[model samples]
Target: MAEEKQTCYEGSSVQSFQFYLEHSGEHKAILQCVHNLLPGEFKRVAEGKSSLDVLGVGSGGGEVDAQMLTLLQSTVPAVPITADIVEGSSALTDNFKALVAKTTNLQKIPFAWHIMHSEDYEKHVKAKGVKKFDFIHMIQMIYYVDDLAESIKFHHSLLKKNGRLMIIIETAHGGWDTLWKTYKKDLCVHAITEYRSSAEVISCLKSQGLKYEEHVITNAFDISECFNPSSQTGQRLLNFMTAKDNFYQSFTSETRAGILDLLKNKCSTQRDGGVFFNSNLSCILVHA
Candidate 1:
């Protein structure tokens, strides 16, 4: 185990993230958001516009972005879409580019992909005096941001009138939140990334007096393997969960044991012969 601590973003951790995506209920939650609110919201935003501008923060592999654009197309046919995708990972960018290449549906959407994190994107926008966007979204990516209020305020400012800022994050008081709250000092990842949830976002919006709509998505993930000390996949998943690079082997036995106990008893529950995490999410739509 290494002496130094690291955030989940450290190293080439995309493989573990992909694995987590596949194993978790995150996709289902996204689909729920799309079906329940996004289509109508897209239609509302596009009703009077000849062209739509969208900014996607941390658009990973373009899957959700593609779905959203497809919804936009369905809602308002032949409406021109200009999309700007900002992501930190080149591999995800490559995957997004490949996904776009193979998918015929998004051919009409003119896309500009920027290989940078959200903070850098903000800098670039400030330097370039970027135009306001009709829509902006960040899905499960808020955790990595340096300043929650600044990021929220900046993104909210970028929206055109009657526009929307979409943010999806883990719900506060969920198992993950409890775990982070209990062990953040030892973990040390919170300092780097804020390690927050929907509650913080909502609080920020409320404090900012930003008008918004909230959508709650309840889902769970299989965490049964987390108990297996020898399972490499389990260790990686734990690392991803805690935003720690080497969570299982890097910590003291007491800390690790306590964390495991919290994971089993506090953060998760058992069902269907598997340990399911309380991995709920809240999707907030800040109105501008």
Candidate 2:
């Protein structure tokens, strides 16, 4: 068996991760994209099913998962739902469960938690001979998979007839795309780069002749804190984005300054008198 690789999100301190989200504005951007995509407007092809089976890959804290499920319920009010969540973090899994317990709308919805990475989820489900799902969602988490083609194939295979697989990833020219690509080539050999951008994923889908639709969501994060070299919060943001501990201190001063300058000039834009790291989020819906 191959050794499991540790992800930046899984290895970092929870507080640092939370702080990165807050400072980077990814939390709201993610929710906004989910809200835009999960409306009752989806074609009711799976209309008459008695129960809906939803698989949430890398569901994180479950806040977004619950929101999506609530929207799904509105579309098909009478169908019972079974949400099977897969996340690698125990803390995030617990947080998701707590969210389910407290939210009235989610309280009535059935849920199962799988505290494992996406690949592990596949292995466990295959061993148990689990059936397919009516809906499977992978939101902003595909960048961590080692093989994007294999992962997409597996996720698509797990969808029942007329089932939908929804994926959210950054655009080809987005800040994250540039930063991750640079870091992958220069620093981290094990870094995940397959399907890192919407363009890449779309290319894969086109080559495979998969029927899919893509939507774009515009979002930005405040990178003003990163202007100060001595700022602790700024360092944390850098560390999280690069998936490196002590990013500023890890590299030579010249290299560190060059990277920081690149981030400031190339990765960010000055908007409304604020330094915003512009992001282009692509929502790809694939029908089986």
Candidate 3:
């Protein structure tokens, strides 16, 4: 893995994500998945617990955080929650705050925002001698971390008795995985380069002798545009998928063509007269 200075979230990465969300219907898929998991997981953790302390890593937009908090509230209606959200992007943090400000439901829950990455949060807690958390969540944001195992360990250590650490990531053998693996091999070196899935994280947990449960969240995207060589949105979608800026111009004609063929043939399937790429993601609930 070569050292990467820039990430998809840095510049064009944000635009790429937004583009994918608009075109692919992944936003709905994500929310549906989160909604699906909340009831069981929240009930399991909130049982016999009167109050909750939560630490959220990579809590982008805070929409998902709000949802989980709401569910937790419903599970233990009398229990109050104190949430600390970790987000590195100031723009995203502000966006989350704005969303929270607008939502009446989220206003009732107490939130303390930490404008930093997971590692920074670890250090901050250690420095302040912070207590353990009852529930922790890392949503769609682990690709930005340096070491998945170490990060998981750090967050797990912050859990209190009967606490749960929930992690959500794309599956290893999905279209997203294929695109990212190809991108790193051919295009650029991103520091946090590994495109990990729930399977991989499960393996990590098993190796540590930790108990965990896995849930599958299936979704797909219409990547038919990538077949078109001249579509700007297609190229930007490629950039988003690969986390490379101007991906069309970054590679040679031969490489670009090869990448497109890989995405079309290997990553996607022909269905309903469109190319649908199934993104198999998973949510893991861990308890020490």
Candidate 4:
């Protein structure tokens, strides 16, 4: 019998993630990386073209989408842009809609929301005869997909000739990987997989028979600002690190205490006050 497929985002993880996003300063970091990845000029380039259709795959909370919308509105005012947000979580979709309502720039653009899994969205696009999008983006969410190559192909199919498919991934290179490797035994359980390198992303895109351009954009966060035990940010981080009950149980009280202490000390120190983490965003600007 075939093994059942594992769901990427669980309820507990989603709740924890929402909390973490609010406090961890990752939102800012992500926004910065994305800004550097796709400068305002790209929007102008797309606008100079004939047709404009943009799709954001796995658009969680619509934070990045909101930014993209703002860029498009400013750079390509003449182009009537249609953005389709493909997200599976209803809660996330709801939050995205609320954000859209609040943001003036995002509200001005014509947009659609599809509450469907990435795979299902691909199928729907194929069946509905929607073949090409001017631009397609997957930001920090591709790691969750079961089959990376297949997923890339699906998104590639949605691109028009010479259209660009951009992917922004958080590089698992610096302190982020160091911390995870050090605490993996005590902090990680369930043997989840993470794509940790740019080469892997490049290889996957190549296997899909797509040619692309790549750029590495790096940004850092000061963990000191959010690592206090008594602070809301610190608590959120704790909760995020301990999402699964069984996973939490794997660590001895002493080990848990030690990790917390380490985090606290690291956050408090002036020399390393900034929990410096960098993301090398491998953007594959593909042509169809």
Number of the predicted model whose TM-score against the real structure is largest: 1
lDDT of 4 at 48: 52
The runs of at least 3 residues in candidate 2 whose Cα sits more than 4 Å from the true structure, single-residue gaps closed, are 1-5, 41-45, 187-195
lDDT of each: 0.83, 0.77, 0.77, 0.65
Candidate 1 colliding pairs, count: 0
lDDT by residue for model 2 (1-288), tens: 766556545545556777776776666776786676666333354566778889999888887788888888777777788888988788888888998888898988878788777888878877887868988989878887777887888899998877889998888888877776665555554445442789878887887788999888778788887778788877888777766677777778877877777787888898787688867688899888
Instruction: In angstroms, give how far residue 115 of model 2 lies from its true place.
Output: 1.2
Q: Candidate 1 clashing pairs?
A: none
Which residue pairs show backbone clashes in model 2?
Answer: none
**What is the alpha-carbon RMSD of candidate 3 to the true structure?**
3.1
Residue-pair clashes per candidate, as listed? 0, 0, 1, 1
Task: Please provide, for model 4 over 1-288, each residue's C-alpha lDDT reduced to its tens digit, 9 standing for 90 to 100.
Answer: 534334344566677777666654766766775666565535534845755788999887788788877776666676677889988777788889999888877766777888777777777777787746877888777766767878887788777755778887655454444444557665444423543445667888777667887765555444553445466565556655444433235567787776656554432233543553342345556667
| Candidate 1, 1-288: lDDT as tens digits | 423222234345877778788888688788877778988888788767888999999898788888888887788886888999988877788988998888898887899998777888898889999878999999988877878999999999899878999998889999878888788787644524446888889999999999998888898888898899899878888987766678866789999899989998999988888888998888899899
State every prediction's TM-score relative to the real structure.
0.93, 0.91, 0.91, 0.76
lDDT value, candidate 2, whole model: 0.77
- Provide the global lDDT of candidate 4 against the true structure: 0.65
